[model samples]
Target: MVVLAVIIGLIFWVTSDDSGKNTANSTDLSGTPSYALPSAYSDPSASASGVPGVSGGSSGGGGGNAAAPGESPAPGEPGIPGGTPAGETPQPVPASGLCPDQNISVVLYTDKPAYVEGEQPIFTIAVTNAGLSECTRDVGKAMQSVTVLNLAGDRRIWASGDCAPVEGVNNQLLKPGQQVKDTIDWSGTTSTPGCETVRQPVAPGAYQAVARIGEKASAPITFNVNRPAAQ
Candidate 1:
């Protein structure tokens, strides 16, 4: 009888142990009964769609970094300056807007057609813009000069540049039909290049005056220099 009772007690204990373990495992994994979980936790797709911007939807209907409207792209990016694309070179702006020579007309002028020996002669350089647009040039004393050539126009006698030259940068913009004039006085003395030779007073005779600016020379103009007694 004792053996029989021991067998029954062992079977009952095993059955109760199995039942308790099954109940604990099922209830623990079934989830918290006191707190409710979000729908995203149950449905995997809800996690992607419920949160904003997490989805693969972006500008152009695709997933990539897109600049917002009215926002400029960062520099050094593709298609930005400094990394300019081929055949799209940026044009450089010039400091001096110089005009073409064909558009500029350099006309020479003298204060008078006659002067007395030992008298100072005045020469005027008139530069006019003959083009339809505005342009620039350096008309400073550094680029201007006057020369008195023999009637033959082959020999150069006196020149404004023979002495100390005027200096400065006088860049000027000229409009169509606009004219600028500059004046220089002649000492009526002959001088060599670089003022290397002692200058001598020129002889009384008919002389030609020519004005120059940069590489442009004026047409020779006729003028006379006579002895002071004849004036």
Candidate 2:
């Protein structure tokens, strides 16, 4: 009976030892410790931003949601990244396709270079498109100016804009070598800065007429206003 018990004890000890060895070798099969999961195993629905199914970075592996190099935003869209909101239309960009200021020329002329006192001054402004291609310009009162200055060009005596309200913008497309002209009759009287009211008639003297558009001005044309001879 003692020998049989000894054999049974040896068999049991051997079986227990083999079971522990199998458990240690099985780690490679699961690729994870029994107490913890692998680092790569994460919830499929969760993202870094804490939003489900929505990723933080760019799609297609480009890294971020920015326009590609050398690409511009479509018109009416934000000009730069993180600019205008998604739906708001952006302001139009000024076009440089039109002719430059150097391609335009202005000329001021009057019906009579010498005017008798109390005679209305009939003036004309001529603008020529001297460019090689067609271009557009604002020919409205807002962009046009006619000024009368003293012979020395030191004193401004009158201006077309003083009493006139610039109604609206008039953009005209001018062909190359084309000319545009306008005429106005000025009261032979001085005016204040605002032209709110006409001042006294200008004294008999030599004066200059100047036509201007923005910073561009025509060559000054001289004229004389003389008192009428007594009958």
Candidate 3:
């Protein structure tokens, strides 16, 4: 009887130990309990949908950062990547204004309308700004010409540029109603292309004086030279 009781106790002990091991393995395979987990932990795809203050999702389909509503882009700045804002026209950059030839006027004058046979003629060339705005111009000697034409056959008698050295640039800013004047004294003589030899004096007669700047010219003014009376 003592041996049989010992055998029954041993059998009960072995069965209980095997049952405990099987329960432990089943618990491991079943994972955590549903009631113990947080509510948001149920969905694994929630993280990829984007969380507040966190950037998420793949690079396609407007997944990048964006400006908030009611926000405006900086002035003259591009709003979108490689794109311009709709309904906005680009402003043109301003440029410095330049002077045109139509705004200038040239006038020629002589100290006296008539001079004695031996007297020299004093000539004046005046350039006036007739525009409403200010402008710059090259008023150098290279761009000026003084010509005298005899009325007999409308012959060209003398030109200031024929014997004068024209050098240097005279760029000047001309304001509205401004005038620039230049003066020269002309000998009672004539000049040609090569001024190597002395020229004879012009005959006392009626002549027209004209001044020119670039392609623009002043209106012709009549003048006269008289023969000297016997002393």
In terms of TM-score, the best-performing candidate is 1
- Model 1, span 100-178: residue lDDT tens: 6666677787888898889988888998776767888788999998888888889989888877777888888888789
TM-score of each model, in listed order: 0.57, 0.56, 0.55
Q: Per-residue alpha-carbon lDDT of model 2 for 10-91, expressed as tens digits?
A: 9999999999989988866788656755457566667856566778664575544567689984456456666643432222
Question: Order of candidates by TM-score, top first?
Answer: 1, 2, 3
Off by more than 4 A, model 3: 1-98, 196-198
The segments of candidate 2 whose C-alpha lies over 4 angstroms from its true place after superposition are 1-96, 196-198
Q: After superposition, how far is residue 182 of candidate 3 from its true place, in Å?
A: 0.5
Candidate 1 backbone collisions, by pair = none
How many residue pairs of model 2 clash at the backbone?
Answer: 0
- Please write out the lDDT profile of model 3 over residues 187-221, one tens digit for every residue: 97987765665777989889998898777788789
What total of clashing residue pairs does each candidate reach?
0, 0, 0
| C-alpha lDDT score of every prediction, in listed order | 0.80, 0.80, 0.78
